[model samples]
Target: MPVFSGIWVALVTPFNEGAIDFPALRRLARHLLDAGVSGLVACGTTGEAAALSKDEQLAVLDALLDEVPGDQLVMGVAGNNLTEVLAFQREVQRRPIAGVLVPAPYYIRPSQDGLLAWFGAIADASTVPVILYDIPYRTGVRLELDTLRQLARHPRVVAIKDCGGNPETTLALIADGELDVLTGEDGQIFNTLCMGGRGAIAASAHIHPQEFVRMADCIANGELAAARVIFQKLQPLIRLAFAEPNPAPVKSLLAMQGLIVDELRLPMQRSSPTLLQRLRAELA
Candidate 1:
């Protein structure tokens, strides 16, 4: 299995006039790659996957793949529909991706046994490795430590995007050394890495990606002081990226950089004016 270490950006999908912006998407992927992110995750929560159509999601994945090496790309596979999710997984594996980031079935909130079976089935069908996404806040269910341990034993289940919001689970997973624990929460990146996390799939990395990358390297190289400085400096930016509901705040900042238009699909709106002002000050 490939080591999923360093800073992997949970990329935000770019939009223009309420449609998928392929050109902007391509540029954003190249920008992050050039800035030296370890990898790129497409259609993840940060990308607003819930809002994108199936075709749009695939297009976004293809756009990233065009700029990123297959080994450095992971596509997010989410939804409560098991059959549909599995079918999508089959199609996603056809590409030479690093792996798939699969969250638990949302709204259904399955039991540990169900969680195990759900992920096991996906792993069984996946040609590539599976990175379990344990984000209970969004999915409405937690992958208990024991359940995670069971999943760890699966040969194809390699890593996890640890957003369970429980420090105990995080530490235990690190100590167990069964799965590579990548921090999904941007604010927790430094502590997670210091606690022996493999890396981060950070949405905050969309801006100043090199800093995030450098911080990870510093931590890995035992430069705690340097890493601390970087993390402290980035705290405000990280907080601001998520001040609003996700990509809204993130996309606003990106728009200020002329990277993409400040737009989002309905049901999801743009960042508030106050937040936008703060973003400008922070970027300045």
Candidate 2:
């Protein structure tokens, strides 16, 4: 495994006037790196991967790679089409990424066997390690524990971004210990870490990233009281971040900080006025 531990920010793609804001993206990547996140995940759900064209995604990756080391970057890859996904994987593998974060094929809702085959084939083709993304809610199918356990046998399948929302599954995966369990659910970071999980791929960390990092360190060092206090302070921000559809409230807060313009692609809008008020209050 490539030590996919600690807080890895699921970076939002900053847009400006309907275009990918490369400078802002670079600045944000540098900011997160300066704040001490373990790594950055570009083109993930938080980054609005679905909204970006292949060229735009690669450009974003390029900008981030320029700012952050390749080992400190994980690129998100998802699609219902296996061939296209594999081809995209081949294209991205040319860069020295830490690994590719892959979700099960969306929309089609493949059987466990199909899921195994899908991830296995991608894992086989990928030169870098694979971080299995078990976000069933977005992908429309769960990567069940048994299926995940089966995938663990693959030499290239090294970690999991767990958003399955099942504590039993989370506990099982941690107990199994075959994969490094990094919770994708921001709110679960504290609990997941306490439960013997490795780290987080948090969207909420974008706001006060150092606190998220410190919280994880506290838990890792067995300082539960300190970790609990940090989590309590961060709870409100996490709630507000996801209050709107992801990255909206996140981008809103980031824009307020002047990190990026608060823009998101259409179909995905900016944070609502009500939530913006809350975010402002929270940031204040």
Candidate 3:
């Protein structure tokens, strides 16, 4: 089995002056690891991977390799164009990364056959396992259940990050018994775990690492009642974080904690005043 089970944070890439902030990132990574995150995804959507330059991406991975303990899982988000993705895989061939997390080609909305071919090609070239990331809302293409099953059979293809955020899909994936389904939606962590899924790739874990851990513990210990309470308490904050575009509210919360300056690259901006007020109230 892949080592991606349990609580893994789709870590936020810290930034300053519109560049990768290494110091803040290192602090955040160490903090999350200490707080009991099972793994760290360095260049995920929460990390604003799209905004980072290629050199910066490599630098982030290098920094992570240096800072993160070998036991902790470290995955790089390398889903992009076929050429770019292949290049990224080649670049990180000798790196210490645990594996790569890839989504279907975004913006292009490729057909299912196209999606299958694309992931197959990447898997063929990858040095380590590849985790399928299926967030149709962002990718504009859903890797269907059938497609996922096909991909799961590949030796190099491992678990999946299921951000579809539907219990039916969660249940079906769990029932299928072939693939490991890690919930990507924070709001669904408790419920997802209840459905017998492995765990979560929660973005909100950056804020409440303990709570997600608590949820996992509660479920494993068969304490659903306690898990329900934490789930309800976290729901509002979850909504707030996703109120605007992602990373905006999350970065704001991180700034309030004095972890990193709230800086974002262009086309992605800070949360609006209304959302900021709500986020502050939650943090307070």
RMSD of each: 0.9, 0.8, 1.6
- Ten contiguous residues with the weakest lDDT in model 1: 1-10
lDDT of candidate 2 over 17-119, digit per residue (tens): 9999999999999999899999999999999999999888888888888899999999999898999999889889999899999999888988999999999
Candidate no. 2 TM-score: 0.99
lDDT of each: 0.92, 0.93, 0.82
RMSD of 2: 0.8
lDDT of 2: 0.93
- Would you give me the overall lDDT of model 3? 0.82
Q: Arrange candidates by lDDT, highest first: which order?
A: 2, 1, 3
Per model, how many backbone clashes are there? 0, 0, 0
lDDT of 1 by residue, 220-239 (tens): 99999999999999999999
**Which clashing pairs does model 3 show?**
none
